[model samples]
Target: MTEFKELYVRKGSVAQDYIDIAQDIYVEINNYFKIIDCNLKFCRMMNKPRTELFGTSILDAIHEKDKIKFQNIIRNALLKKFKDGIIRSDLVDYKSRIIATTMKLNPILDDNNNIVGMFVKFSSFRLRVEDSAVNTIFMSIYNSLTDLYTIYGTDTKIRINHVNTSLLNILGYTRDEMMGRHVADFLVKNKDQEENIKKLFKSLESTGNFTGEVLYQAKNGEEIPIHLSISSLVHNGKVIGSLGIGRDMREQKRLESENKSFELKLQNQSKLAEFGMMLQGVAHNMSTPLTGIKSSAQLQHSRLIKFKDKLAEKYGEDREISDNITDIMKFFELIDQSVSKLSKIIKNMMSKSRDQQSLSKEALNLAYVMNQEIEFLYANQFFKNRVEKNISIQPDLPVIYGLYSDFSQSFVNIIKNGVDAMWDSPVKKMDIVMYYESGAIFVKIKDTGKGIPHDIADKIFDPFFTTKPKFKDAKGEEPNGTGLGLDSVRSLLKPYRAKITFESGPGKGTEFIIAIPVKENQTDLNN
Candidate 1:
């Protein structure tokens, strides 16, 4: 057996060793936005030791007005939208003095090019201006305005005169390729955007500046969304050109899309929880009356049998009377069978709805639990009417232990997935088998529906990775394919130390096998 503690290793920080000697104030923040390390220059600038700065939120040092913008910058950087970006902001020093700084953000990526942290360099614009008038413009234009800077000649053609490195990188163009081209050649995204550009120029003519959202076309024809602010550049009290600075909106748009998706999934989950409560309540209310009906059925059954016997004795020679009595008894037997099934279903519902957060674990009969889930699924019209089910359970299986909801919920989710997978198939069938061996109970659920696609097999268990249609209505009661089913199964099985695996392929259908360890000390309820 491998010990849990042995599967780990420690690593040292290589960033500190390399960035410590750099002149600019450098800091590294993990993906969570916590400052993890900082160079000595950063420590001195804040007048705080590295100990006080490390592990703190970088947001603490950013001015309140720029916090949201800074956060979006970090999000976009982590998404690898660009190599590096520069933006201006006010930073709070250790003495709480506000310093205007131009900060550049660089994404630190792992071998797979996935961003793990952010590297930030801060240059105090105030200090940089103290050098000289010539160098101030040079540094501010090259360093401060590095995000998406463009200068257009304000001529009849509105020709581009200069483009910064950042703009070139974003547009995938060189200075030579972009210098003489009309600004509309890159800024026009569509006919609508072209009209918007006319409006922008109108605004600029009246106000000498325009700030709004627009689309910029890259060399490869990808439309890049950006928030742009443009101003008429003046030289000697005369307008010569227009300057444009833009912030990339790709990451912001992506985040909004993800947030919408999450909200839908959350709504679906909420509806499911509500439905569960309603079902549990109905089961609770019907349980007692259903049990009474079953009891009355049994008593009436015994009485009818006795009455038939008495009549047969009195009219032994009458074949008609005897035949009538036999028919009556058969009708009573059908009623009895139905009531018995209903009783079992109600019992299972009550058992499944037992408090899931109970303080103590209970020994659970795995076969019985599976049977209850199947019974509950049958309530679904598709499963009950269209699906053909085969079940085989080994006699006298050992008991597993857990809160009843954990096992019951996991089984239902897996079985429900099987049902949903087969919904569109010509042949809809399910096979379930359970047995015990080597102190573990195993249950297998197989379906004859369309199987999992090969490309997305690994992601099937990932939360919110559904191929289902987007949620459109809140009135729907079912899960609406939230993609949380399997991910939740993975979480629910942890308490039992259970393992679940599956075999699936397109058109061949899917089979899921779950192995749950049976602990000897967990048989209290079973006994």
Candidate 2:
């Protein structure tokens, strides 16, 4: 009989032991509670000295404020014969810190099935003191005190949660008047800003965060500019809402505008100074040729009259004297040639000067322009012998839209540099190639002479920078140039949107590439 009872009872104990172990491990165990009755596992979990806790009320450990709720739970459990119930409240732990508790209750029954009492189990749900203090510091620092702060819920409704003293002062409104209002109510002055705010919230739903400047309206119909930085508030790896901090930028915007105006005035003054210098150089350059032409004409006039008088005396007949007069005209003819040459130079100078101020938009044949500049450069005696020139233009290259004089000057400057580079070279050959790519015309001038030094390549295009020997006057004394040729070239090409680049190394050749945008509907030579 004893062995049969042991085997039957052992099967019932397995299920009871499983429940007892789960209650101790899976539930909170540091909370305040009183045990009315417990299983063997609960007895071990609480370290109780008694064998059973039946017939004991579990309300003995209840705090004064929660004793009424605890007693009500017990009475309800007895009336309903509840197998399990719960009471949620706060209690002080052994360390005297307030801890939140959720108590689990299990009612006991007598042999007649009448309610006897209840067993109580509880867990502590409060955060650690250090963790709570750190959270409070973070909240105080991140929260703005000088602006109206808002957080957007996941449903996209803006909730006004914080209003600082400065924001209330600016808008002439009390904190109560501003808090709890929608963000749109303050955005009345800027419809675009309101729409953008809506778009920002919608985007945040997909992309987590956004920040930008916005304009808000005050209660008195005034605009307030703000620099807003917004980020998503996340919890448990999920974005719950968005937080925004606003900084006023009205004074900042005014300062930026003032600075911009000052800079524009300074740039205009600089350009005017450059223009005055260019005019002075041009006047000085033109005076030499004009003086020479004047002297030559005066000398030729005297020689012509003397020759006419001598011829009239030798040839007695009137018709013969007329013929001799025509012969004397040849001397004047030479003077005309000098004057014509001077006129052409003056005309070219005038064209260059006018082109500096007014850029003309016309379709120009780049190859023809290159050839003209080369012909002009070759006409000079020094360049004629010093540089060997080869020009190859692709037949299918199209015309570019640019000012004629400006484009010609750009090519002339490069050709002049090429000639100057070859003065010391034994084999002075320059290869120029023109081609078209995409919508741009490219002219590459490559020279077979000592190239620019690698260190000064970038400085070559700078104003007044030169590698050429100092200019010498007619008596071999060094003369100074205006040192504005490359500067003028750079300034002229700015309006045309032209690009220039070069590749050079010592002993290896120098290559310069000029690319200009081609015009639509322009014809190519090959076509």
Candidate 3:
């Protein structure tokens, strides 16, 4: 019979309907952190069979250093402030690899208000490591970049001064005793090596660097082998001093019976360059997949909207819930909105780092660009619940004839700096207002983040200067970043002939305003 066959078809289609609706939701698990449940997407992300994950504790897979943070997050879930709070952290897998993750924790309470469990809704983001990773990778990054350890000297007279605790412990010398002495005073001389040592010092003076094996007399009167490196410290175009890094070569000698001082420098530089390339690749990989995801969601939403229109036209009547057809149409519309929002976010993030193709000046809608930029800000994981925002643009704003990408880049950079400034603040909010006045377009951005200290206010715009801490991993080990972002902002605005200035009070907030002059003859309204 038709009725019996229809029932069978409905039952067969039930699982498909569930999958479609759950696509936007996250994978779930029980309170014990056992993998009692998961969606197909989460299973794919983990690349694990559901059966193998059934009895395993999620915490069991996390790195040891990060477990305490995870536990604190669990405890915070009990507090009302944090019950619905979003926690950003890294997740570890069976292979001991760290994966950056952002998730919201919703505590489930029972009839008596007893805490039962929690539901975690995971959000998608491209991860940026804040700490250094494991030993091998950390060592390569540590050596070639910045000097974390070893002895130091002044080139004026080679005075052994300003030694750090690390080198002090290694050399068995007190800082007070070494400060005034010439570096050569500590050298353990050989019968025939005095002339050779002088030649080596002279060679470095001319070349501005040295990397080689050397021997020095410890405070204990024992000769110690060292892998030494020294580079000129230039100031105002003069070599004011020399910075040196010396590693104890004993362990390396025991393994390879040779020094790798020069090789280490090369290796570090190579690793740093390779890592830079890897970051670019990661950006491409993340963006390409997200673009595809957005397209697919958009396609589905489009189809659903067409079907809803068909229903409206065929029925020719409006009734509340009307067999739930209207409800179904509304659901699809919501999905379309969400997917579109996510797509804008992804597009903004991807465009930020890519080399902006040169654009000739053209008329651009100022109001539209700001709204797009604000929506992109919401997509940022750091500002999800961390920062509040109020943005207002004057109605029917006059259009500006300029490089569109330039304004976009400049605005995004300011917004990003505002976000970074508030990282330590309790209340993080951004207020933005744009208006036309006095034949100029004015845009102001203000943040309730830690304001610029007077000392560094002068240097914030300097090339290669940044207050941003080095990007490290969960273990808190390595350093990363190029502090040229704001400098580029200044350069980006050159063609537009814009004037940018800011006001700051420590702990109060910082506000940056940009003003672009408009010609009186230029059109003020598109209409």
**All predictions: root-mean-square deviation over Cα?**
23.3, 18.1, 43.8
Global lDDT of each model? 0.77, 0.62, 0.65
Order the numbered candidates by TM-score, best leading: 1, 2, 3
Off by over 4 Å in 2: 1-32, 35-90, 93-339, 359-388, 391-399, 403-428, 435-440, 449-506, 514-527
lDDT of 1 at 436: 86
lDDT of 2 by residue, 1-527 (tens): 23322322353476445545553311211112344334453344334433444433334334557878766665676676443444575544334445466666544445675645444455544423335767678556544466545565655535666565666666667778876777667764456886778776676656766677778788888888887766778889886766777788887876775466446535744684477458647766886877687677666767777777777788754777667666666666677677677667655545444543444466667787776566556558766765676879886567566667677767877766766666667888989899988888888988877888988877776555665545663234222343445655676677666788888888888888877766543533233
lDDT of candidate 1 at residue 27, scale 0 to 100: 76
Q: Which candidate leads the pack in TM-score? A: 1
Q: What is the TM-score of each candidate against the true structure?
A: 0.53, 0.41, 0.38
Best by lDDT: 1
Winner by TM-score between candidate 3 and candidate 1: 1
Residue 119 displacement in candidate 2 (angstroms): 9.7
lDDT of 3: 0.65
Total clashing pairs for each candidate: 0, 2, 7
Off by over 4 Å in 1: 1-146, 156-159, 187-202, 217-223, 313-319, 353-375, 385-424, 427-527
Task: Using lDDT as the measure, name the better of candidate 1 and candidate 3.
Answer: 1
Q: Which 10 consecutive positions of candidate 2 have the poorest summed lDDT?
A: 23-32
Steric clash pairs (candidate 2): 28-123, 36-53
